[model samples]
Structure formats: C-alpha cells, structure tokens
Target: MKKLWNIGIAAATVCLLSLLNACSLKEKNVAVLSLDKSFTTRSGFEGLLNGCYNDLYFLYGKEDFVAPTELGTDLWANVGTAGAGFTLYDHRLVTTDGNLKVIWGSAYSTINLCNTVLYYGKEVKGYTSQAELNAKLAEAYFLRAFSNFILVEEFGGVVLRTTSSTVEGVDNAPKRSSEKDFYDLIISDLKFAVQHLPVNQGLRGRVSKKAAYGLLAKVYLQRTRLGEAQEYARLALETAEELINHQTQYGATLYTSDNTRSGFGKLWAGENNKTNTEFLFIQAVEHANGYNPEFWNRGRTRQFFLPDLGGRGGEWGAREGSPLYGRSNSRRFKPSRYLLTQCFEPSATTADTRFAESFTYKFYANANKEITNALATTYKKDPSVVGYVIKGTSAKATASVNFYTQTIEEQTNMANDAGLAVFTPNWTISTTDKAKMPMMVSDPSDLFDPATNKYKDPAAFPDEVNLTNVHPALKKFSAPLYAQSNQYWMGDFSIIRLGDIYLVAAEAALLYNGDKSKAAGFINTIRKRAALVSREAEQVIAPTVVDIDFILKERARELAGEHMRWMDLKRTGKLTKAYLMQTNPISGELFDASRHTVRPIPQSFLDAISNADEFGTNGY
Candidate 1:
C-alpha cells in the first residue's frame, strides 16, 4: 500500500551484511535484527518481490527524476515548460543529474533482488508446488526484463549485473555493457518469461502468457528486429483479441470502473487493475506517499491532465481556469500552448472524443457560477493533459456541491446564453484573486443526482452542482476532503493498456504488412468508441490508404500524454522535428537544437567510473 521508491542499495547491503554475522545470535545482534531469515525464505522472497514493486512503482509516480521518465519525456513531446521546466524538456533533451540517479539506483536494486531470488528461490527448502517456483522465476525474469527495459530506454548502455552486488576485488566495479548486449539479455529474459509464464494465472494481477508476449513484442520492436517485432506483435494482439472478444466476464473482475478513468489513458494511472484484459503489469498503490510523487518533488501532478479540476491553490498552479486559478507557487513543470494545440479539439465538433469529455477543462464559472469556454478563462490544454493528476497530501480543496436551476422552457432553450450563465458562469474569475463572488453560491450538500437516489433533486440537479460544463476545478485526481487524509488516497499508475496494442497492431498491419484497409478498420473501431466523428460523415473511419505519418499524429492525438508520443516520434526518427515545432508561449522559445534531444549522463556515474571518459555524454 505504501509506495516503494528506489532502494537504498548501500543501506540494504550494510543491513544484510550485518544480519549474516555469526555472533548476531544474542548479544549485539543489530545486523541480525535488520536482516532476518525473512530475507532468505520463500515468504521473504515474496516480500522482497513486493519491495521491488514498491521501488519500481516510484518510476511511474509524478516525480520526473524517478517516475516513468519515458512516459513524460521520451514517450511524449514535453508537457510543461522547457529551460528549467518546460520547453527544454520538450525535445529529447534532459540532463541526467541528481534525481535521475534514483532511476539508475532503483533499477539496479531491483535487478539485484531478482538475481538474488533466481539464485536463491530454488535453495529454500519445504517449498510449494514446482509450478509455483517456476512461476515465481518467470515473474522474476519478467520483472528484470521490465526494469532493464526502463534503464535501456533512458540511460542507453548500463552495467548489467545479474547477481547481487559484489564487494570482492574482481567485482568491485563492473564495466557498462553495450546496448546491444543489454538488449540481448532483455530479449532472453522475455523469451524465457514467455515460455514459462502461464497463459492464465489463478490470482488476479499476476503476469500471464499474454503479458509476456506483449512485453516480448515491445522488446523486439525496440531492438528493430522488424520481422520478430511483427511476429510477436501479432501474437500478442491475437491473444489480446481472444480475451477482448470473449463474452466471459473474466476481464471486468480485473479492471472495474470504481477506481479507474474511462479511457485508454487509464492504463498509466497505475491503480485499479480490475480490468485484466489490458493491464499486463503495474506497480500497484494503496496508501499515498508525498515523497513518491510529483506533488512532493514540486507542485506538478503525477502527470499533466486537462486543466486543473480541483479548485486551484494546490500543486500545478491554481486549477487553471477554476475560481482557484493562480500563478503556481513552485513552477517546476508547466503545460504549454503548443502542447495544448496537440490535444484534439475538446469541442463536440471535433472527431476525437478524448479531447472532449475524456479531459477536464480549466474554465470555471464567474460570479454567476457559470463556466466560460474561452481560452482566457481555460487552463492550458495539452497532450500532457492525458497524464494522471496525482492529488497530493497538501491539497486544499474540499468536496462541495454545485447547483443549477431551470424551468421546462429554460432547460430546452439551451440558446439562452444569459440564462445559462446564471448557473454556469460566462467567465472564470482567476484564482489569482482570492475574493469569492456572492453570486457563486454553493449547494449545501454533496448530493446532486439525476437518478432516483436520495441525492436526486431535479431542481438542483447537475446544473447547480457544477456538472453541466468543464470548469477549472474539475481536475482528474479527486481532491482529498482533508489534506492529511490524502496520505491514504489509493490511485495506481499505468504503463500500458489494451488500446495501445490495438493501435500498434493497426499501425503494424498497415506499415509492415501493407494491409491498409485492415489497419484503418482496427483504428476506426477504437475511434468510433471514443466519440470521434469521421472526417467524412458518410465514411466514419480513418482511411485505409494507411498514411504512417498521419497515423503517427493520430496516435499522438489519441494517446498523447500517456507517455508514448515521444517514443513514437523517436522510433520514427522525428523526435527532433516534432519537438522543434512546439513553441513555449511564456518565453517565446523553440526547442534548442543542442539541448532538446539528449540528456546528459549523471555526473555521479562519471565520478564513480575511472574510465568514464570513454562514455560520451549526451549534448544536453
């Protein structure tokens, strides 16, 4: 439940060493107290695995230094400002420094744990079924591959240590492995995982054959083994199709609507794995940890989402257009106009529904408590808006009711702008001003329902409850009623989902196999569901001519801030070009050629390695 950030490798090592001391039986058994048999047994192994999940989970949190780096940077065009904050990050540019090391250290720590388990899980006596052990090893392999995938994507080449950290002369320091070699290891591990992991796991949230296949396909795609990539991608897609097409309710058990948002983006939200059909692997979370997310690192949310929904004054600036709007206190990350333009039009006329209801807008009601759709009163909408808004412990907004009123003719007379303005404001008063308008009356209770529930009152239904339109206070993460109680908020972050596979397969079918119509068919299927209107009303689907370039852009529109956009560009060799087009409104800047593409390797690594000069640093 508690988030596990990166492992303190040095501290863990010291503790383990002390625990192994023979004299730790009685007198001064401090080491034994720290490192008990729990670290050595099957249950202990499971605990370590859980601990590994905790550490890895941090990679998916809000903190850029530790969370899913690719999701924020490499996966998508930059969401926030550049230099220290936004534009600088838009291009493939990032300087690997202090906190970036957390990713490296955490990754290595997990590798060591998995290696230790693979080495020792077999030695433990009195174990469960052999199937369980194999499954555990398979899981270990899958995790190691997953972790390595992260490292390879970020740091390029890394020292691949399969065993526990060694202190002996020969193992005191290890040289970095070549990227090819590193990826080879990943491939081997994934292949093993694919072979050993069961197609179905009895327990929910467990990795299955489909998960392995999906990962294997991903690995192949990254390696640029086109044939292998296509083969595995098809295999994964086929398996996924079976699960999706099946009438059985097995999937709903895995992913339920209670906690997750209703879109492809939910996969990266990191919580609520009830929909087993899509989520292959995720680092689950139950309790909140301030230090583990962007909220603690700075004011940013887990990732950017539509303009802030929670009444402003929390992290990520006052909810963009809400009554709580303001200049953010710690402007670490910021959404830009260029990025906003990238998200499909939020209006009903747009073909992309994700741009509409899928996101919460920043505009909130003015004195009349009515919402204005004007950009001035709206938050900066962007691709990053698709990212999760991890509500922090210090959030100040409290749950309250919004009210609306209308006569029968008034309800039908939707064109009465002034009448609508009474319930929904025509303009949003910026949060910069703390003054509250008297006309902005709050509904007394948190009960405004359309159904036959006790909260249902047609007179004060959605209209008065602030439900009729997108407002700045409508942030993705529900604000905690009490800031302190936020520590207990349960939200999982996602890394992948079923929708991506559909998109990927659709793209692959057209690009690699020359099956344009089939690709368009698959993509159209997804688009239709999202409320996206077809370019031609008579033909409601993406064309089958299969424009790879167009589909790439479409993917950005559909999947943007979920952390896949940047990578898509990178693989297509458009990282630099795509980002250069993004302009920062605050500074009137474009992506700098030198600083936009590559991140500098951490200085600490340079300091640790004697021949570090051999490894060139990224231009940034």
Candidate 2:
C-alpha cells in the first residue's frame, strides 16, 4: 500500500493521469503520453487520494507554511534577523515574496490533484464494495475542501478550481471566486466528507468523520453567518462529545494530567503513540530514504523556535542531559514578551505546567570549548571579568541561564571564581543591592523574599531581552537527532488535536450562542490540564467569563508554534487591533488592517493568466 501510494504521488506530480484522456490527442500525445492513464480500481483511486495527502504534508511541513500564519501574529515576534519571515512579521510583504509564491502554487497544485481524483472517480470501476468507493470519494472531498480553505484564508477570493485542469488552455486562467462562493463550496464538500467518512480510518494521519465535523465547525465559525456558525458549532460539540465518550472504540483520548508524566508537556515531546487520544490528525513523517532533502517528511518545526546561538558550537550549546539537547539551525521566531508574561495570569506561570514545559530557560555546555574575552565583551559586557577562561570543563557546567535557577547561579559563581566569564543577556544580580533582582531560587523560602523572586512584570523587561541569541527558547519541537548532523529532524506534525477541539468548542459556544458558562466549561477542561489541577480545582485557573480575548490568549498559550495564530486573530476580527496595532514589535503601528488582513495574490500568478488583470489582485 505504501509503495503504491508513493508511486501514485510521483505519477500525480507529473500530470493528472486520469484527466489526460480527456485532453486533445495532439496535446495528450506530447509530453503526457507516457503518464496518461486512468484510475479504474478502488485501490487506484485510493492511491491517487493518498497523493493529495502527500502534497498536503509537503505544503504544511514547510517553514513558509508556518511563517505566513505565525510570524506576523500577536504571540510571535521576529528576532531582528533578515529572512523570508521578516517580510511577513513586519507586514512588508510584496507579491514577489517566494514564500507567498510557494504557498499559492502548492495549495492550487494540491487542489488540482484532488479535482482529478473527484472528477475521474465517477467513471472508475472494480470497487470491491460500495463502502470502499465512498471512502475514497470522501477523502478526495475532504482534501479539496482543505486545500480551498487554505487558499481562502491566506489569499482571499482565490480562483476556485473544482474540476481538473486537464485541458491546458481552457482551465488554466481561472478568475477569482467570491469569498461567499468559496465558503459555500467548502461547507458543501465538508458536509459530504462528514456524511461519508467512517468513524475511524485505522491510521493516525488519515482523516476521519470527526475531523470533517471539526473542519466544518471551523469553516462555519470563520464565515459571516452567525446562525449557521451556531448550528455547526453545536454539531461540532456533539461530535467532540461522542469521541470523548468512546475513547477506546475510536483509539482517541485526551492527555490527562494524572496519567501522563509531563501533563500538557506530553503532547509536543514526540510521544505520539498509537493510543494518543489527543491527536485528531497528524502528518505521519517517516525517516525513509535516509532523510531525503527534497521530500518534506523530515520536520523543520524545531528549527524555527530554536535560538541560533544555542545549537552546537555556541556558548550556551545543546548538551546531552538537558531538555534543549537538540539541533536548532535558526531562531526565526520567538515568543512575544506579551505571550511569555501577559497571556498567562501571573499565578498561572507558576501553577501552569505549560509555562515551564513549553520553554527552556537554562542551557548547558555539552563540550569543552573556549570563548575569547573579546567575543564575550561584544556579546555580554560585564566589567567584573579579569582574565577569564570562558570554557566548560564538564558537561554539568551551566553555560547560560534565562531564569534564576540555583544550579545555574552556583555554576555562574564557579565560572566567576575560575576566571571563566559568565554571560547573562536579559538579567543580572546585584551583589550590593539584593532588593532589585528577580531571582529564581530552588528553595521555596527564597521565593517569599522580594530580594530573591521571579520578575513580576515581564512586559516591563527591556526590549533587548527579545534578541535572537538570548531569548527564551521554545523547547516543544526540539529534535535530538539533529544535534550532530545538519539534516533536519524527522518528527510528526499534528494538524488538529483534542486540546484544539476543546478550544474550538469554547470559541464556538461563546461566539455563536453567547453561552459564556458552556464556553467556560469547555475552556476549563484545557485549563485544568494546563494547571495540573482536577476538574473541581479548575475554577482557580479557568476564566470566569469566557471572552474573545481570553480564548485567544488561551489559544496562544496552548497552540503556540503550531501555526494557527493568524487565522485565530483574523477569524475573531482581532488581527488589526490586537496583533497589528498592539502586539507586533516591528510593524505594530504600520499594519493597515484593510490592506493586510489577507495576502496579495502573487504577481507571477496575475501575469500568467489573461483574465487576471480583469479580476485584479487581492487588494494589492
């Protein structure tokens, strides 16, 4: 089945083989002649549908897919480095940006593949049973809707091509469809998927009936129709409730605090087992073909969140026993100060396991390496240094500290004694005035003293704290295999999870029915898990009134680095006000809401099509 799926994906990449039969003989006999074939069997149709999944995996796994959604949002801030993501974060996006081009091309290309499957499935024979045919058709419908949803969210009112582009000149230049039309099509397709898709597909990556309902809930919520949104939200809630009730039957369950070692931390720590109840859909990545660079099977998510200076050779390098013992090639995005502090209640930072689990504040030196006094002076300027060694003699030596852990402090003191200059980026302890410093001591008694306590107001912390080399590292997607090699790590990317569904339920209840109590009930489920508190103790951590802002903040805290922020902000009409005006450090004031809500249609796309000039770009 895997071999057939691989062959199908390769064949689909060449041309829509099934659709080539409909093209003119002159055109079909040219380059597409060898590949011209139709999927006559149910297995063949299933294989073609698998090809669509492959394309989606490739599209979603790329850094570009993450950047457009995550970079410019309220939760994430750029690290003052120039890259493809800079334009997205700063709202300086031009139509020619390669990221924009890739997203557009990949999404439409996948859509075309889906169209081929759906169009040709009507004539296909050799179905062993009717259930098999319906399943294949349902998968195709789901992929088509998913691809169209991606297009609509990023580039608004995009050309909605429902049929295959087999006849080159006829269907090549499609005009932009209405946003209403696009939504209607998505809703229609998803409804069919929900009706036909089974309860379980027996695979983690494959879409199930629950996934379809979940998507419909999202789709309805995103559209302008409030009544429909409420209806679908109700449907989604019922669907989620069904899944939650029968966990074993569907092979799904929530990652509860009591059973899991890390509680909320277990979700992202690469512990995606077969019985993982949280994951609704995951992009199953394999280390097949020995890390093929061209294939998107290897995950690069960990690289985006990692600080560039903390990889292998840097001062605060990744070491063997630490949580951050992984390869991090780039620090493209960092958590905004608002997210690290303001998003969570001050008490939640301590009580909530997510705060500690999500980020790494301490770094260790894995090897014995020297740092010159000049480089130390440039990176960290401290006058106390007098002929420092600046080398780690042992792996246990704490190289750097973002938080004020006692082990780190003792290590720093040792470095100072040994003339090994210690570098602290955003914090410092004054030996003379102990009253001012925010210290994190191991002893609980030290927390009571104002002199040795955590920083009260992280928002008031200096802007320099957000720099690439010194910011708090996101440790959720850390890949240990990439520690020594340049090749990116192979890890599964989760599309939707039970935690996300809980939040979606909360949002839907709040927005659609204005049922704050029910929304709170849903929100409490996740909050309780986050705080490691029981259902009865949830009131302490859960919000009393479920508002849009609170839900958005909760989403940020729960779903950061998962690539869902921009849509959350945009869907709730909070993008311009919350993200563009208030949150973004670089382009906060410059973001024009009307112009920047959706991306501009790529210039190359407009130039290729003759009717595109008449259709115009996405408000470019």
Candidate 3:
C-alpha cells in the first residue's frame, strides 16, 4: 500500500484535477478518500509534500519574485525599457500590478498545499518507517514556513493560514495576523524542520538539517526581536561551523580558485549540479520530458538579467559554449554602477574572480559576418536594426566598427571594395577578416592587465554608460543549451548555498558580540575562495570594520543576481540611503522609505476579501 502511494498518484492526480478546476481539491479529496484507501500512508504524505515543493516552481520562478527582489537594489539598475514587471525598479508599482497579484496569490496557494500535507499526514497509518514519515513532515513544515516568511516580508501583516484552506469558505475571509505572530509561526515551523530533517537528504535540492539551520538563522536575523535574533544567530553559527568542520560528512566544500577556474566561476559552469556539495537548497528544474508543460517546470530567470540584444543577435549574443553566454529576449535590468565599481572594491574588474565570472563585457565575432550597403542604410535609419555574431574562432582581432556610428558611404565603400569579401551588402568582411574582428565589446577596459593585476583604465571607465544597450551582461544565470527559442534560459536556480551560510554566520557573530575579528574570519573564508590575498599581506581585504554596510558590500560581490539585494537592504534599513539616494545615469530613483519598505497588498486581493476595508493596503 505504501509502495502504491510512492508513485505520487494520490497527490499528483488531485493537484492536476484541482489545477484543472481552478480551485483546491484537498478537502473534497480527504472526504472522498479516507485513510483506509492508502491515501494517508507515509508514501501518500510524501506525494503531498512533493506537491508543496512543486508549487515553489510557480512562486519564485516567476518575474514578479525576481523583479521585487533584484531590480532597484544597489546592484541592479532598470534600463527604463518595457519588460516584465519594470515598475518594480522604478518604484511605480501599484496595488493592481499583475506580478504582485501572482506573487501574493501563488505564495498563499503554496502555503495551502503545505498545510494540507501537514494536516493529513498526521492521520496516515501505515508508515514504511517512522524516519520516512518524520522526514516528509519536516519538509512540509519547512515549505509552509518559507512561504509564510516570503509573505510577511513582502506584505507585512498578511493572513496566516496554518491549516489547509481545504475548508474553502472558512479560510476565504480570514484576517491578517500581526507581524509577530507571522514570525512566531515561521520560527516554530523551522524549529520543527531542523529537528526532523536528516543531515543528508541524498539530493542537493531537498531540504536538509543544515538548510533548516541556515534559513532559521536568516529568519531570526530578519525578525525584530534583537535578543532572540542574537540567540538564534549563535545557534546558526554553531551549525554552520559544524558543517564547515566536517565537510565530508555533508559532502560540502567551497570552490577554490585555481589558475584556470575560480570557485565562483565553477558555479555557473553547471559545476553546481545536483551532486555539488556547496548548494544547500536549489529549485530543481529539469528539461521537460515532453509530457509536462515546459513553462510550468522550466526556469527562465536568465532572460530577465539579459541585455536587449535582439538586433545585435549574431554580433553580441552568448558565446557558443561558455557559461557566461546565453540567448535572452528582454534585457530588463543591468548592473548598477555602484555594484560594478564599489562592491568588489578598488579592483573588482581585475582582482575579484567573482566580478569577472559573473559578467560578460565582450562578444566575439561568430563567423565571417557582414552587413551590406543596402542593409547599412536600413540599419542607419533604424537604431534598433542590429547585427549578430556567429560562433567562430577568432584571436588577435581588431574591435569591430560600431554599427551605430558607420555612415552609409563608408558602408558602400566597404561593399564596393573588390579586395574585401562581401558577406552581406551592408558590411564586407573576408573569412580571414572574421578571424581578426571582434563582433562587439561593451567595455574594453574589462580586459585584465596581468602586469598590474588590475583592469586597464579602471579610472577611465565611466559610471554612466548607455544603459539602454551597453552594459555588462549577467553570465551567472546563463543557460546556453537550455535556452528556449533564444528567448529564455532554463536552468536550476539555487536558493541557498554554503557560501551564504558563512555570510549569515558572519553577520550573526558581528551582531551577537560586535567582534570584528570573528566576523572577518568567516568573511575571509569567502574572500580566500575568491583568490584574494590575506588581509595582513594586502590592504584591500575583507573589511576590518564588520558593520552592516561592509557585510552588504561583500554580499553584493558574492550574491548579486541571486535575488537577495532588495531584501538585504530592507532588512538592514539601508534601502533608501544606499540605493535610492545613490545617483546613477540610468534608472536611479528617490525611494520613499515609509511607503516603499513593503509593497501594497494587491488591489484585487483587497476587493476579493469580504472585509475589504479592514484589509487596508500596505504602505500605500
């Protein structure tokens, strides 16, 4: 009977049916199929738990979550172009934004699923083993807590739906709980998760004891109770220390920078796959098996960070096989000047492998490509008409002429030149010339000068570049092979990693005792992996002052584009001072701290509630 339930028919079937019906079926199914029907077995509960996990794909995997978390932070600058949820960065979001509605609804929907799993799993009889049952329940608790945490953080005092909203009418009109109550539930749920989750789940994506500890540490740090925050931080540090001390026990180790590859470099290279030890928790996105809808199961985060390269396809898109190269549709957001220059500090462009590994500033000539005289006129007339680079071997190449600058006469002269090979009328290029020409280069200064061990012309690089088209393309989320029609990238997105745990512990220690040395030690561990020299030998090492600003900068260098900046700034109350006030040539804004800390509860949500007046908007 347990084996029968392991196939996930009980949960998957019900979930599919409910999805079709556009409403939850948990209560109805519970009544229709009792515990005796093998629907309440340990395996049955596991299926329901899987459903809760699946819901995350819908919640965090969307643009809404990414927009609120990434854009308008210290790291990213909105390019003032229309993309999914652009208003988030501009701080022009309203109560009726589509993405907000999805975020709000999807979070609660996932929470409901988690509640259902927890509610009925206790009543199940035939557990194959008590350990299995406990593990499944532990996962449910973690998912429930995580969903609620996202809710409370985003909306402040949101409705706390603990039990399954299976009884639809009963839950339909629930009131918002106090912020303290929300944190209490999150803490309790995480404590339960830590108690029952195994140290090793045999899969990197699954929740583990270490992951629970890491999340708990973050939760406590976020909560307003300073004493409790310090206490939990200590607990989190102990667990992190233990994990670091006994790496083999948990199959975890930091990526070390070698001559050829940096630890941060290895991560985007798909080296952080399912078995990679550094990952604590990941949203597992596999290539669709042709049966499931790819949209529901695949990850497209890579699309959001991409630069608008629609016209410059062959000339400037991702490299053939490099991890930093990928096809992207909407180049929604670009790296903020602050993040590019300050976070990695005096020499990010050269010293920090993380900076180099995370961004693509150059695109090589793909093939013997050219634009014709006729095409050049058209391209000149339309600024959007851009060329692309074909994947090819090219070395010692002169930088390609800026298409934006070329006159039609110059293009015609090149086209008529008998000595030149005309690949197309707008431009002429020999196969020989292709090997000697760069397709596109955004920032020529990004090239490192080994003699000085720093990027050339570091001071000359302008803080304000053309934000609309030219900027560093984020390579961290690149998924070349998994791209869908060269529009979106499909890759597994990591939610937590051991590197982050170290930072968490560092912050916790700093807050707990104000001991800079202790905090610096943890931060240095991350710095060492980045190939930074020891602090004693180098003046530009991890901050001696272990303050929030220092820690925030370090986080930016290490964790940018991982959807953490907004939360980090908000949690530390630095959103306005660090991000809003900082002027940039692109999409900088004057954020209203009082009203912008939390987003407005979607207008649709308020209108749907019975007591709509009581459920007032947040910080509107």
Q: Say which candidate scores most in TM-score.
A: 2
Ranking under TM-score, best-scoring first?
Answer: 2, 3, 1
lDDT (Cα atoms) of all candidates against the true structure: 0.44, 0.59, 0.58
Question: Per-residue lDDT of 394-513 in model 2, one digit per residue for the tens?
Answer: 322222221111122123333433322222222223433322111111111111123322222324434312223444566565533222122345555577777877788778777667
Per-model TM against the reference: 0.65, 0.79, 0.77
- Please state every model's RMSD to the true fold in angstroms: 12.4, 7.3, 9.4
TM-score of 1: 0.65
Winner on TM-score between 2 and 3 is 2
**Where in model 2 is the C-alpha error above 4 Å?**
1-5, 14-37, 81-91, 167-170, 202-204, 224-249, 273-275, 288-297, 310-313, 316-329, 345-349, 369-468, 479-487, 533-543, 577-579
Residue 274 in model 2: lDDT: 30
lDDT of 1: 0.44
Tens digits of lDDT, candidate 3, 345-434: 435235557777776544433334544434434323232223322333332212132111211112222222211211211112243433
Weakest 10 consecutive residues, lDDT, candidate 1? 401-410
lDDT of 1 at 444: 14
Task: Tell me the deviation in Å of residue 21 in model 2.
Answer: 19
